[model samples]
Target: MSNKNINRLFEALTPTTEQNEKMFQNILAQSQNENTRRRGFAPVKRARSVVLAAVLMVCLTTTAFAAAYTGLDKTFLKFLSPVNNEQAEYLSNGAYMVDKQVANENGSLTIKQVIGDSNLTYILMNFTAPEGTVLNAARYRFGDSMITTDQDYQSIGFKVLDDGNPVDNKISLVMNIMTKNSIAGQTVNFRFKDLQAADPLPGIFETVIPGSWETAFKLDFKEYSNLYQIDQNITMFGYEALLNTISVSPISISLKIQSRSLKEINEAAGRLKEIGQNKYSDNYPITINYKDGSSETTSIFTGLHLLDYLNDQMLTIKTFEHVINDKEIASIVFFDKEIALN
Candidate 1:
């Protein structure tokens, strides 16, 4: 097949897992039919064996690609989520290295490193199996986990990056923690109850050796972000919004916004709900323009506080998929109005 045809064939194939077996079976049937048409003899068993071998090759190739990332630098480059130059460089320098490991009967878990500001924290962790043992799963899910901080906080959420792919023997995981207050300078306690491998079908799981593990580490949060205070009224989706402030960090950019009236708040809430349902839609709160003449749009809206809806007071934080270099930002565009940063 030509290169373009090969690309199309690969794209046409369903993703690996539960559908993989059925797809291979169809290929085997087709191969048998073609062989019989040409030679008047069907090699059914041979065709079946070849199809199964193809499946094995696909699995092995994926595992090999995952294993190619050896060290911190290479591993960071393999992050499924977008990692900008600033975040990658900081991780490469070992500026926030926390090589803490906790081992249980199941295996060992290590906190490779971390990077965060006040509102968010990103943790890099690795799982290593015992000698003669192997964790050969595409992805894993943690069960009954409790992530707490030393200080009393409003809320905390710990999530393993589902978007990331896993490797055999050594599984690398990224934990994204969202908190009500700054997670910096605070010691965090991580407790996990059970670990399971995601099964062939969605919502099905298989336990990974019965065991639990726990660990704690102190986070060194540094303020390497630029904050611009802006109190202006902007019209979005035909509703008036108050632009409170814009904080530009190396890893992400967040914008704080509010509504001017209760009616506007309710209307904006409904509109945002509609936008959230569509994954491909971009919430046009702010656009970051870099010095290199490139721009990025906000991927999601987070840190929403609507308890004070009566006073038309709410905090809307919009985040970018890739990191934003604070120094390289030229300006921010909102509703066709450009605010020069430099």
Candidate 2:
């Protein structure tokens, strides 16, 4: 599509201020309802058909974008929002580098790594996983994690692999286990390879449980950091969250680069800028896949800024799909863009 047209598409996807408030309220209500239901109270029942019908009405009212397909026969509604504007310089060597440090009340972790090729534009993250006693065959809910998207996190699973076997040693299997209840019993060992790249980013990486369960099960990182010895924790969440976070992070970084190629970047930037301008309806959505077998569809509004970062660069997005045993599952997409550093 022409850059101008793409820009308009993006603008349409940006949600209005009022819409944002409404969405926030809806989320709060949903959470409260879930809490109530978990307490053995009769849950409030809203008409599913009515809700679906209303979402359909919203979808039909907007012409900018429509749901191409709602997988799993689920009702899908778009919640779109525009991102902030920023600029960054593109490295010619096909690599970009990123390093981040995250701290919580209990402890902290630092991530340093090259994302792109070492000889090209490279990005990297370095972080040490907390070590603790392993809880075997433990299952935890992820609905309470601090994530930004609407996708369900319950579908994601994490396991500790030792010689290809699921192990209960939490400290040693840092890269494979997803959540932990307590760090008191056993230690596990894990390497970076055990962490599949499909693992979600760090922002939404929080322990999952109900308030009571969380209160009873959660352990402070400080309590186990010294006693547990694990090299890496490869935690994976729902496929959608993992893909969305990865795309958003690098795209946000690219926009922060300083460069003189406005004309080239503008081509891509215009598409994003148009979204900011509200040229189209707020229902357009886009799907992203990763190099691993994971895919997610996010509202176009959420990804518009990433387009602006690319501009006129030769970029290709490829999705990798994989299946194990007979189940068709897992996929990831790689975003490849060519830039002239000199």
Candidate 3:
């Protein structure tokens, strides 16, 4: 379709008020009446227009209902939905119902408060878990957790930490966990804090499963914050005996701040190149230091990139030192050249 027609269709699809729905219904009724009135007297061309208009109305109605249904489904699926024979049995035997009643009766899971500043946001949650269930760990990601374990279902409580406390009302999070067998259970009473400046760039957070019980996760917060001025951090708490079961620790946190501009990183790269050329030699080690405390020393011909130069008959530079300014913020280092010995 033409761009203008597509834009018009989008505008029409946007919901404005209840009057729009009423008008659509009226149009539909009128079209039906017209079809019936012309059942025996209309020309073929006029009949085709009426039929096309009726079809368009039906299409609009279908699109509206589909959008509404999708939203409702998403809301329902966000919470803990029963999954497996074990969970179903628990629900059937009135375990979940009893837990809900207890939660309602005690009223212990209440929103404590929310706090935030210009650069940070925080929400504090205080609640207790049910009997037989202990919170093993809590993690926040840009999306849902990839944990697939039965122990997640046994979680009873959760706490979320932020760069700063929220300044407004408390934010609520509906906690859900997956068991070892890939079963998910829902528990409420978790707190949520949306940081205003915490935006991770694309492809920064990558998860690599090293073993059955251990996963290596890497976060390039420096590279991420380079794209935006927002600073973000992740704080995780491990709980119960499951903490020992996993390879990681009790509490692990990572902080990335928007401290340096893109120009600073480029300047550092340029300085490294100049130092590398001046110190290049056949058998001497090259060392470069920045005003900041950060430094890297590596053999020019021994690292991963050296394999690509095996066929070249050039002098094999083997060692070098690099130094750059270290700001209180995050930084990225790019090796400009291999170190050589004189």
Per-residue lDDT tens digits for candidate 1, residues 1-342, read: 233432343343335566677767777777777787888553658767888888778667655543332223334334422234334444344336689999976788888877665556677777777766666665566656688875333333333432234434667676666554457777878887677776443446677756788888888746445678888887766777777777666555555667766465455545544343334343445677988999876645544333355556554444444445667789988764577775
Instruction: Evaluate residue 199 in candidate 2 and report its C-alpha lDDT on the 0 to 100 scale.
Output: 29
How does model 1 fare in lDDT? 0.60
Report clashes for each candidate as comma-separated counts.
0, 60, 30
Preferred candidate (lDDT higher): 1 or 3:
1
The prediction achieving the highest lDDT against the true structure is: 1
TM-score of 2: 0.18
Candidates' C-alpha lDDT: 0.60, 0.26, 0.27
Candidate 1 TM-score to native: 0.62
lDDT of 3: 0.27
Q: Which stretches of candidate 3 lie over 4 Å from their true place?
A: 1-14, 18-170, 176-178, 184-342
User: TM-score winner among the candidates?
Assistant: 1
Residues 157-209 of candidate 2: C-alpha lDDT, one tens digit per residue: 23222222234322111111211111222222211222222222222333421
Among residues 3 or more apart in sequence or in different chains, the pairs in candidate 1 whose N, CA or C atoms overlap within 3 Å are: none
Q: Compute the lDDT of residue 83 as modeled in candidate 3.
A: 31
